[model samples]
Target chain A: MTLCTFIKAGLLGGILLAAAPLQADDLEIYGFMQVSGSSQTWDEDYGASLEADGALVGTWIDHAQQANAIAGSEMFPWQGLVGLKDNTRNDISFNLQQLNVILKKRFNRQWSSFVNFEVVENYKTDYAQESEWGSFSVQEAFVRYAPSARWTFKFGKFVPTFGNFYEIYNRTPLQPYLFRPLIFEKSVGGILPPEDYLPNTMAAQVSGTLRTGIGKLDYALFLGNSEESYFAENGRNDTDAKCIGGRFGIRRGLFKAGVSGSYDYDRLDALDLGNDVVLAIDYKVPRMRYGVDFSGSAGPVSFVCEGIFVVYDLDSDQQAVVDASHAAGTSADNTLDKSFFYAHLQYDAAKWFVYGDYDFVNDGIQPWGKDGVNALIGGGGIRLTDSITWKFQVAQYSYEVSVPHPLFGAPDPLAALGGDLTPVNAPAAGVYKGTILDVQTGISIAF
Target chain B: MKYTLTLLVLALIALRATAGVSVIAHPDVDAGSVDKITLADIYSLDLLALGDSDLIVFDLSDADPVREGFYAAIGKEHDKMKKLWLRAKLTGSGEPPTAVASLEEMAREVAATPGGIGYVDSASVPKGVKVLATFE
Candidate 1:
């Protein structure tokens, strides 16, 4: 059956089941919806030079276009790269950020099950008219068995315990800000693909907690399929390797601290330059990530912070291909070692709360000709009622990079056509810099 | 003399407004009493079982003053507790406690259901239940 038909059928089945006469305590259904409006303004000082026949040729281009071109290019995997057109541009949009529905069933005290379905970005599934911005899918479905309070096992698909916020970042009602910290916001694909930095989902998990004199110790170990590229047609491991990860933590009252680590094989359809032609090359590399996080609350104020480092182990051949196709002149060391960290603080009261967040990322590849990217965000929310909240946020991002991209100065692919190309008069010592100011307001309803 | 009497009555009213609560459980539960840390764990949905029986936690409505006092005594915030419960439910760890309308209902439900637990004002310790913890 078609995808739309399947979705309709599944929804109908859920409705019918809910309508069935079951004990209220045995079955539960609940969800939340978030709607947001955003305004973004970009300010950039970008410049590039064009050369013909190895001679200086002046080509004046719009600064906004230059920024957009570089951002949209495959060189950098920055988040929100899509739909960027100009510098000093003001773009406004209203979006249904997310709609999530959860179904939970309890079969005695030892056995239980849960399923979460999420529709994101104003998802529409009409066969006659489909939306371009939104998507619909089941985020998680799992069955859990708890023989005791301290021991439990989960089977099926579920988000494994990672750095504190990875599992709950998408649950808008649980978060105080309209936009999550940069490292955890997967919806806006950026420097760190949370999938690569942390295992996003797992098939089976074993977890437990131990109460201690000082605090409670929590631990979880999970196994899942290998990470695959976006081009992968099916949600299956492309290689024999599997992803394995675990987290361990201690909690006392409102204080918690944790360390998490994961190992996985990543398969990507990378680009290869051969005989002045760009070709798609499938490459597999082993990746390892380690992270540390802690959070605590003191009266009306609370704070949280986490740091992560990722290392990609590529063979000599794979490294050679990456150097040739991706990071030609960006860095002398093409090792792909990335790190990210963020700190957040918030003040919460009975009816309102305010928060501040700062995060930084070093995209291992350094596509922007800069050391790293930094974001500072401040936001607040008002509790309209027990089930509704209104939130607002203002975020600023800053990064520096060279325009015309240093790659253009490399062996020109157009040279084979009797044209020698080069870049002249590049920015003098880190003159090109860009900043983005994003303001968003949203309302969330939980049922 | 009239002014002094009025002040005395106001002080009495303030004292009653800040009255504490008693954590109660079904009579069959083996645990006699609990500390603040254990009480926080139970109400936060982290502690799922008491003794041999699985725990069934109940609460008064969100706006209830006794509910607020119960959380205050345990040193937890309402918003934080809500988020904790949400996380537990989504991750399949546990579910939020069922909420009743009033203290009387909370006492009745906890008394009727085996393994049930709830809290009520210190002044009203109903029959058919054992007081596990009290905060004054």
Candidate 2:
């Protein structure tokens, strides 16, 4: 939709959806500002530079969607899951990020309903702006049934049941950095991209806290439509099989730990040489992902460490096709097993706070040797007030394999094909190896 | 004169440092002296039931000297506690303790409402509310 349509749609939705009007005192207005001046070297060696004009304003369809986009691919995993080319080099300015309107009111002693109406600007640094559902999407609209203090049930569209990062820190005000770690992102690749990381899903979930000997235990159970898909089933997938995912956590001493994961099954038609070498046929891609996270706080220091792994399983026909492609010197791993990991350590003293994070991925989405990113980021923030901070940060990304043909430098055969050109046999050059520096100063506020 | 000023300053610091915390509840509440863990849970909105009675939490204003003493006694900082409440509000968890302007107001509300629990400085403890715990 155009910018005009987006504004009108949001207004209409806001008016129509104000049924049980929240009491003025019941409504909480919270949002954050990300004012930053950044200079990025997409590849310093090539002198490829992009300047941030200092201010970014984006909230195209949902809260933080563009912020999520502008975070960019620390290591872009896939190229064409949705049949669109992602031009990241031109995406330089994305700020003025998120505004969240949360209405939570208790209906009775037993029930309360929560609704979040989020508005975002869908603008690109480049010349294309597109949104499937205009520029207004419900971040979360749900009702909670709290039978007791320890147990609760939710029904409606809400944050997808996935990881702590998405549920907790995905908000602009909450995130210490502008971009998210690659593990929480769904990139392009595999027979079909898994419907794992879509920001929100319509679901029914039950969660609660338990007083167990193993610290205080918390658990969540979710079953929903694994929407984001390329297969025939879009917005809802694998009718025969639904996505089952949740998290289990417990706090012990000064530390809190949890394990969470999801599984999705999908089917698609594969075009291939089929012995006679003519057409691509049909196959199924069933994928599973799991992760473990631990966080702790001591004195003025707090830290979190998380590791996630996703594996895509191929059936006999798919394996046969991969074998055929391999025999023909096309590069496709037998059964895609990808791993991603990130760890964060942070410390705070008086008015200043500092942090360091490491992100690594063995995505197997790209060609061999070019399949991972080891990035270390360190930064600090000075608190100007309880709600505002000034932060400066630097990030350095180290590629597992050196790219023979750097981005925008030489024409790379595989890079040209993108992820849409499957099998990725031409052995595309890996990520450009060099000193890629991203330096930014931000004024952040949350209320 | 300098010596007198220093003594005055020390006395004010001492007064701020030693504000006694009174964890107050409704007179109808049947709970006994709450342990440190239970107090933490109540303030964090994690523990809602005290025996047969369900409890709601309230707080003196963030800038209240008594509130600062209460948080410190529980081994928490005011800013950190506020952030925790912010997360709770955002994540569909329980809401934060409603802030009242003064300890007398907090104590009075706790005393009148069934299951209402709150903290105040001992100096402002009003009638009808029972002191469930104290941090000296």
Candidate 3:
């Protein structure tokens, strides 16, 4: 229906459903603002060796991937945005951003449904290009049913139910810095085209939390077709992937630890040709507790860290295809056996908090190899009001690789491909470093 | 002095006895049939409050204490259910049950309504109506 018709219909329903006057129930209005500035370093020799790494080297085949190269590219230096929030007594909320509109509703006390539409913009950077950046599309739409207070069953499009930063820390109210983790920002393939990391894929997921005698157990069962075929005319196929995994953790008082993993099968016609699987473990504990003499006393200081390992199972045919593409001087074969680790410490007292995180991603399986990525991020914030906060942070990312490709003179293939037409199989590696200084603040309130 | 004191005490007791309220009921109802009513039960039962202008319905021929017993169990000092109904109505939520002036009126009206919930003197209960609970 048209926007006008939709609005009219809601108003008509409101009149007919009017109930007891709302006097005792509380109502409030809230939202937030965030602004950040970042500086990055590229391989001093980023024009070559696009074949050295899977994340960058494989981009040579997909034209869209070639555009994401940041080396030999101009930097934005600074970016910011303001978002609005609206919540009602019945547990419903609305957030509108550019072409995207999000709505959430809680049914009775156990179930809820949410829908988010994002408009793509038409813009291109060496790193990626979003075709419909300024256009509208459903970013996340799903229904969540919670049988108890701690578990949920969600079916629809949502962020992958994995990784710490991918879930909770990504929210504006909780994040320590304006930018996401570097491994996520730089290496992970987006679920969407161009720079769309963790693309909007359609799937049905059953996830819940369990309280056992030992501690707590959480699991997720997911099944869905490749994001590319989700919206197609005939979307369901045997080739569709299935995922099942669970996280086991123990929490006694202020300390908690858990491990989570998932298995993925890549196929075109139900014939599974390759697989991608990942396992991760995370732990958090209160490291210190101290009080100051002033009325504003500091609370407990905590430490959190996690490690993730990804194993690739490639079939002979897949290996042959990459070999053939490489012989033609066009394919950028980038694949790696590696693990990513991150550790951070956070101290929160009253409305003020400070944190420091170190992230590491190895490009290959060799010990002390000359190929890897490491980053350090530090930031802190103070709450100015119940719905508003301000933060400042600094970050740095560096890459280590030995080989250099000839085409783009960088360590990766996107540089070799030169522009949007770069082959997906090229490889490039080099040490690039820079510091990010960002100051951001925002407000959020619910009614 | 002791004789005079005893005589004075007897006079005071006589006066107090005459001043106390009297409970009335329909002639057919068994006056001593029921036991005590709980606070929770009374709330769920949705009993009505009695006032000077209110018209209560009951058969006068039964010997049951339905009317007198219920009458005694109501008011600010007894049943809280009456107040809850009034509060619900004032808040624009629940509607209070209707009042009838006679047993005949009550039976004829309540028998036709769906989920018909009403109260009458135990002695005045009609053929179709069911007696859920009562108090002495």
Candidate 4:
């Protein structure tokens, strides 16, 4: 009856019909599971508001992170495991921190269809009213078609091909932390929904492989609605927002280099909010049976910093939608712009790796005035098998702004008292700071 | 010495008849599934090249003796199986051979399907199926 249900039914029917002869023996099945523990510490208290003292205020402390102090240490179970193959029974699985399914059917030799699905935790209702098992969301549903030896066309709701980590699984070899870069989290166009599902926003894409003089070349082009859209008699359209992008990469000897870029136009609902553009590049070399990946990028920054040095631009147009959705009737501040930049380095050998990351983000104001989340993270991993891995990490963080309480107003007494008692000028009205010890292990199997 | 040479010549002539591979089959079946099958006939088969059977319908998996024989006898026309799979996965055109779990399953699958052909241990040959050749 619902949109989601209709989509699921249609896809399922398509697969069954395609498997008419029904060779159960032709299917392959695979999957994995994982568990972990983590601890967190904040630089400020739960509501780290500004004190009477100004310069001496900002500090880390809290059960939750706000503008005042740093919050630290939270732990839980994480999934990890993967199966490399299967053909006896038609099934495909991927182990992320979540259980993902890859459903595919081989229609003869030249054509086949595939669908990738992920489960998302919906924290919409009262946690108490919900079942402990958690709810699920279909992160991706699409079909891929390769009609030639080096070219392919795909249609459906799939992650756009914009960033290296967006389409590729396994972050140990690409990013520095288990979490994404700050720029990735707060940036406008880079932080796609189903955060961990894929990269860029959902859209249609065309990509392919080509033989070069020395090795090979890979490229892709994608088109999608920007961060905002207007629903009309004809369905959805960019109206004022749209995202168009592409990625190019080349392989030579033991090295690979790539570049990605995208332009976003955001509006919809008759409001001229703003826009965004992003450019990124990365290079990698494999030696000693392992390798190193180095990456960096910059754009019209408006994203919030999850850690130091990392940055991303906010999709002003999309933010405007949420802002409009909750207009005067609610307490919501629609962020219009953001500035971001960062660099990361990682070394991966077989199943083991080590990494480091940094970020810096400012939204529509002086970098320091707009409270920032500056952090340094380091970590490592141990491969239990070809499909499972264990991870360990630590982070050091600092905050720039403070949250003034309801009573304090401007130039509060807390500022006069001196040491560590200033107001934090940030998107969230509170002070924040913290340390965290993250220990987790998981496996991934695919078939 | 002359008598001994004459005796050796007689023995050698007797060996040639049995030296070639035993291209066996079900007496009722007209086509041969052997090391040296006809190119036109080979192409017609919906064949399963087991382990290393050198079913050069399109290409060879490896460049070895059986493969060499197939190409040598058929002329240079086919491609390698490895290249074909890579091409299919990358280009989205054709698919590579399905990797089956065992010879028994391969035989059953091939036998049940028309135009199907695959390899199995000589001892396991079923009644409906026929042995095309013995490589050894």
Candidate 5:
């Protein structure tokens, strides 16, 4: 069935269940809401030069100006290549981050069902501006059966067990930071995309826990449709391959650790031919991701750490094709390997909390000639009441573009104008440095 | 001497106010007593069934001192417990225990429900319920 149809059917089922007369012990309705406002300031220095045959053609700041002009414009296809201007500017916005509702019913000791509906950024379907429209979706709808204490099975759509934070990150009231770590921030349009690093949802899952002598051992296995592009026509696998993953961990008292991995096929519709031109090339490459995560607490201080590695395996034929495109003036080196890491520390008291975390991502594609991006974030929160919390955060980001691409010569069309004319075979290696300072404040309420 | 006697009486009253709590269950429950680990598992919604019957757990409001003492005895913090319950409820694994306003209500609910469990002050051990464990 189509996703829209499935959502409508799920909502109808939930409404019908709510209308029925059931005991208080059988049905439950709960949810939470979060709203926030944020401001960002940028400071960047793009001291790049164009040269021909080892001689300087021109030294201009126009590159930085052009980058700034298309900072947030998705319509500009070359925005990714030039990167953002990161120039001295300030941007502010207020958003209803999320309003989530959950309906659950217990049919018996062995069977139960759950449904979660979410409205984010005040979602409007007909709005013209992207910022004016949000999203409304059914995050999860699943039925669970537990025949014994050590075995439980689930079917439907739900987030697979991966990492320590992916499953609970959206529960804002439970999180210490208004802005989660980069890997877990689904709403943040960061350089590192979480979908590339982890599996977000699965069709079926089997999970259980064992009470061992030392601690409790937990394990989960899940299956789902293969990964698809963000703009895929439908949320179905394009190939016969499916995504499979699992996580295993142990918990004792307040400390727990887990290892998780997934295997799938990624469908890519476009290929980067080195320069600013976007080429459509359809290919399904084998992808594998693995990660480790651990969390623990000592009195009032709690900390969590996680790291993920992704590898895209291309056959020799595909490699040769990529090489041919690069030799034909596209850029030869094309790699899709990526790695990410983050560490978070928080001190929670009776009525308040303070936290700090660091995030790093290395994109092997190097769309902007940058090796990686690093972010250092700090924040704190106050518990206004049992169900209400107010939080604020400050984050600093550094985009490291330490190397210059050989294929990135000044556009021939621009050079023909003669304003800063340069018939350059190759551009001189230049450093591109950019940074952003972001501040945010928000409140979350749980009911 | 009179002042010392009055101070002694006040201390006794304070001791009674901070008395220990007892983990009580319906007489139909099979288990006679539960260890600290088992208690934690059950109250956290990690363990849904005890023996052959499905467990029906009840809780007192957060403002109750007996509720705090019960969690401390199980080696869990209030905030952490709330998070655990939220995760359980959202994931469809389990639901949070039904909460009653006072100890008297807790006793009454557990007595009327099958496979029921709750906690209350040890000094006020009401009738019609079986004390599974007591913590000081």
Candidate 6:
């Protein structure tokens, strides 16, 4: 059987075992649907999207997001490489948000298990294969064991233990914005995956809380295959090596702060090309990631800030594993690095909220703020009712280098034309520069 | 419209009759009372077993005013409660309380299960179910 088939069968088996039909009458079901009308102007290209999104059991799932929800999440496995890049856009389409089936079993107090099976559209192949329903992906299939109130051991597959937001991504109705910040979105395609923010994976984690004089401390240490997540793309690790990391945080009244880190090894394979292709060497990347996060809530105001840095070192050349035929040129150096920063502040008074978000990503030579993709968001939410929320946000996106930045298509035509409106594909001496205005209004529901 | 308003008024009157909530547990549960924070932790599944005894939490249907009032008294909204459990389940944490159809049904379940904990109208606390506390 193929690797994909093997992985799918194993994942299905694990979740099904956790799903062992406990009590039919005790099953609980819940989820949310985020329906929105989004209008975006990518430099000169303008379009509007009618959107319906869902993600987990109780949570919901989506084929629209890259496999990285499984990609590299504190909730899933570790991080991995990017999905196959696409540079095309469709104006009008309908997507069935998705649904989740969950079975939670509690065998006394020390042992309990959670199993979730999600069915989401396979959008990657939706266009290629017209006749397709959806497929099931295991978001969480894990058992928890607590020896004491201060100690808990989790066995089976689960999301990594990272920061605070990993556990709250699906509660969209409570959030003021419909779209994720640039930090989570960029890290997925860049070096780290967005798994930490969305889905957890098949792994093990130990977590607990302790009371102190100053505050209560909660922490988790996760050990698993760094390459295991990104399930949508079938990007599990190819070897038996393990990835280890954890997060430790303190909660003092209305404020919370924490630090988290993870380390992994990606064993690049050795490839052979008869005579013409030359030899590709196998190398192991000691990938390291570390970040700090802080959150505070003071009555009508709340804020969160997080910063993560990634370093991947290699002792080889650019052409070692990069095939010559690939479109994006290979990196010229052996050491790869990235820094991501995200912060958000919201003030809620009356029935409405005033909020702003600043997110930036810096990858190697293409440093952020120096023209890398950066996003500025200003938005608010109106609580139409307790169950329904109406959110409107304007996300201002700026890209210094235009390489198929999904929201902002890669279309640069003028380095030479002075403003007379040159041909759309004319050759240019400089890089493409432009700002994208993305305005979205969403009516979110939760029950 | 007149009939709908009349039905609404009747429903309000019925809810008022059961507005008071009594925290109930298995007859053999060790604790005679539970604090609001501990109650919240139990509902959130953060505190799995309560005070040396294993626990299986149950709740009246979300629409029950007593259940709503109990959570509201503990500084939680019904919507936020759902979101909290939703996040827990999706994130692979503990499960939400199993929901019973009504206060009577929830009381019956709590009475029979060794470690079961639930809430019901104070006036309707069934036999074999121990009342931990009564709050309005």
lDDT tens digits, residue span A13-114, model 1: 676486456536677777888988888887766533333333223222433333434433443333221222224556687778888888889898789998
- For A1-447, candidate 4 gives per-residue lDDT tens digits of 356645655664565466555547444222222333434443332223322222222222221222222111121011121111111111112223444444556654334665544432212222322222323444455566654435666666666665444443322222224444454432123222223112235468787666566655768888766542333467576254456667777655334556665565432224312111111111111101001122332221111111111123434554454455334212113433343444555565544767666654443222122454465767667766444556666655554433332323333333443424323342244433333333333333322
Tens digit of per-residue lDDT, candidate 4, span B28-129: 334555544343224322232322332322222333333344344433223323323433332222344444455455555555544345444444566665
DockQ of 5: 0.53
TM-score of chain B of each: 0.85, 0.89, 0.40, 0.42, 0.85, 0.84
lDDT of 5 at A346: 92
| Cα error, candidate 5, residue A16 (Å) | 11
lDDT of 2 at A174: 60
Scored by CA lDDT, what does every candidate get?
0.73, 0.61, 0.39, 0.40, 0.73, 0.60
Deviation in Å, model 2, residue B7 alpha carbon: 2.3
lDDT, candidate 3, A1-447, per-residue tens: 446535544553453244213222321111223433333333322222233222222212122333343333343111221111111011111112122233444443345565553333222233233322323344566776655424556777665445344443223444555544554542132311211122224366666555455544545555544335323456454543444443444443335565555554332222111111111111111011111110111234767677666554545654454345334333223332345677778787667888888877663322112345567778888767544566666666555323223223334443343444333322333222222233323232211
What stretches of model 1 exceed 4 Å from their correct place?
Answer: A1-25, A47-86, A123-133, A190-192, A230-234, A269-282, A323-327, A330-333, A402-431, B1-9, B18-20
Give the TM-score of each candidate: 0.82, 0.78, 0.47, 0.49, 0.82, 0.67
Could you give candidate 2's per-residue lDDT for residues A1-447 as a string of tens digits?
667766767674665466435446455545444556555654323222221222222211111232243345344344432111212232255444344556677766557777776544333243444532224456678888877658878888777545557676435556677544654432112212333322236478888888766688878888765544442644445455566788898987678888887776543354321112222324446767787888899998999888777766777776675556444432323434667778889898888888999987763423332446677888888889877888887876655323233322233232343543232112233333444456767777775
RMSD values for the candidates in order, in angstroms, are: 7.0, 8.9, 19.3, 15.9, 6.8, 11.8
Candidate 1 vs candidate 5: the DockQ winner is 1
Tell me, per candidate, how large a share of the native contacts it keeps. Answer: 0.43, 0.33, 0.00, 0.00, 0.38, 0.24
TM-score of 1: 0.82
lDDT, residue B7, candidate 6: 98
Candidate 6 lDDT by residue in tens digits, A205-265: 8888876768778888888765543123556565555678888999876689999888775
Total colliding residue pairs, candidate 2: 14
Question: Residue A1 in model 3: shift from native, Å?
Answer: 24
Candidate 5 ranges with C-alpha deviation above 4 Å: A1-27, A47-86, A123-130, A230-235, A271-282, A320-334, A368-370, A402-431, B1-14
Residue A158 local lDDT, model 3: 63
